[model samples]
Target: MAFLTNVNPALAAYLNEADPTLWSRVYCPGDRYNIKTSNIAESINSMLMKAKGYTITYLIEFITKKLGRWYWKRREDALSLITTFSRGVEFLLALREHYADMMTVERIDGWRFYARGGQRDCLVDLEAKSCSCGVFDVEKMPCSHAIKAVKSSGWHMSTVVEAYYRKDYVYASYAATIIPNVEHDPIGPNIRCIPPIPKQKPGRQKKYRWLTWLELSRKNGSKPRKSHKQYMLVQNADSLDILNLIV
Candidate 1:
């Protein structure tokens, strides 16, 4: 944030006005491990840019087919996996282990310890799964300090990592098959059928709502949108659709 303020005051001011937790993934609450940016969303939007021109039924069918293929592929991949943690989390754990090699741990008790790494010292509590650096609490993954403490206590690295990173949990996540939408299913006669609205210009249509300052400025629509409605739509659709599309 300080760097941003030095580079561009306008961008920095906008960032400061927004909730810090929303922008900085490190300080974000909950088990939001390995989720930093919306690159996954951007990738999907880029993939489906051409589908935006298709009619509603065609769009639905296209997406449905894509999803079915992905679900089958991922399910097979997950079933074949032999590793404990998922690939991404495993990489993080390995990286933290490397950092832990340089750190020193002093046990204060069975659950708590003091670890010194890089130029700083932090208190680590294995039972609570936390470190004074705040990374362990927020990311639900062991930092260097926590890793040192875990090693000193003769605990496995997996003992400190969150359950969400477990192979069973990851496999269970992608286990379900996606049934494709029924083809040529006619709409009911009593129900009114509405076609999707057309885009006036050529460009990739965004599936997610714009929240950042630059994105707000790039918005092309003239009419004012209700912020609450837009936010709700983004939360609901983005969460469901993107998970199916990318995962």
Candidate 2:
């Protein structure tokens, strides 16, 4: 039960006849608050976790390449229009609005991804930063539900980001890899000696006196009776046949 304000004139005008719940559901705090749906994003995280050991190198490079292709396409489209006809900034700027594309993913209830209303559920009460599933944790960019939560809570995205992840934490991993310079002797570094290897012992130790005598007896004897179950398990028919056929 949260209050809905006509925050934006454009949005308020568009929702003139829409369900107040629909608006809430479509946005945050409300969407995350909804007790009724499944959080689908959890499955994606599970899959990712199962696939485990994913290096950040692959993740960062792959996303950058994808975004780069998108930038190139946008630049190409802009250039194509510019070459097609004479246009000024006023016309170009107006056309820019039409040229831009918006992409969105609608959420499903009862899925792995969780939240409240149609908006992203921010459990400020629980310090959920984003969702429990970590989509917010990795992307840093909030999803629709998160955006909705921030707006409804009257908070800024920066605040939400700060609450969950520190500004310094983003480069924390990279910083660990940085090696600082330490003054060193210019001469070839003195080497440390390896610990001496232990001397090898005799093939048979006194502890196996009976075994040693038995082996000697068998070697001296004309033939020896053998009954070993464990060794037999490793002896296949082909191996047995070879012994019989060749021996």
Candidate 3:
């Protein structure tokens, strides 16, 4: 109950319950620390550097002309693949769904972090919001530990995606195409064809044939049944063993 009170007051009040361990962890910070910073310019710049390597001019011109359509049409049918690939650092930091194991949510002086008794592998999620791990702001994406937090929250990934991707930026290319339809209407009615409807298949023959059981029997023999036989035999004792026993 105490943990709920600190982690999310609304949840505590709504559920009418408190978590002692959470409260204890929140208040106790003898071991554990928070990470600092929120900008990931370096990381983004790295991505930009790699992406810029592609020769833009050499690629198809349509991409620059109709970016939205190009992106939309090219989006893979594999939704799962895209969702996983698109998960950036932010989602991980905010959610912290990755490291659900060792870290516990601890808040000291209103700052939150998933702290371990010592500090190796521990993470903090802070926008000065809540996190002991400070990787969120530094990289502008979820740190590995932050991804653990997100998974713990039970929130939809789609919501995270919407928050990260800007609306105008994602929609701009699709909205630009405005080519109007300008084809002429109908002209005149045409006559139908009547060339015996083209031969669809060979016609069924009317040749006479026998279908009686005897006729079938004469044509083909019935499957034969196997003979039922069983044999049991008892072997005599080996000569060497019997001779030794007798001696």
CA lDDT of every candidate: 0.78, 0.42, 0.45
Please, what are the lDDT tens digits per residue for candidate 1 over residues 47-157? 777667655666676677788888788778777778888887878888988989998888999999999877689999999998899888888889889988888888888
Per-residue CA lDDT of model 3 for 1-247, tens digit only, reads 6986999989778655555434443343342224323456565455445334344432223233344445555343223333333433335434444445545544432323455542455555443323345444433445445444454555444333324343343344344454322353322123222245565567985688766765566567863244448753436668657766867
List ranges where model 1 is wrong by over 4 Å: 1-38, 50-52, 182-247
Best by lDDT: 1
Compose the digit string of candidate 2's lDDT tens values, residues 7-34. Answer: 5666565666666555554343322432
Model 3 misplacement above 4 A: 1-69, 74-96, 109-111, 117-134, 144-162, 166-175, 178-247
- TM-score of model 2 vs. true structure: 0.23
Worst 10 residues of 2 by lDDT: 96-105
A best-first ranking of the candidates according to their lDDT comes to: 1, 3, 2
Q: Looking at model 1, which ten-residue stretch has the lowest summed lDDT?
A: 223-232
lDDT of 3: 0.45
* Candidate number achieving the greatest TM-score relative to the actual structure: 1
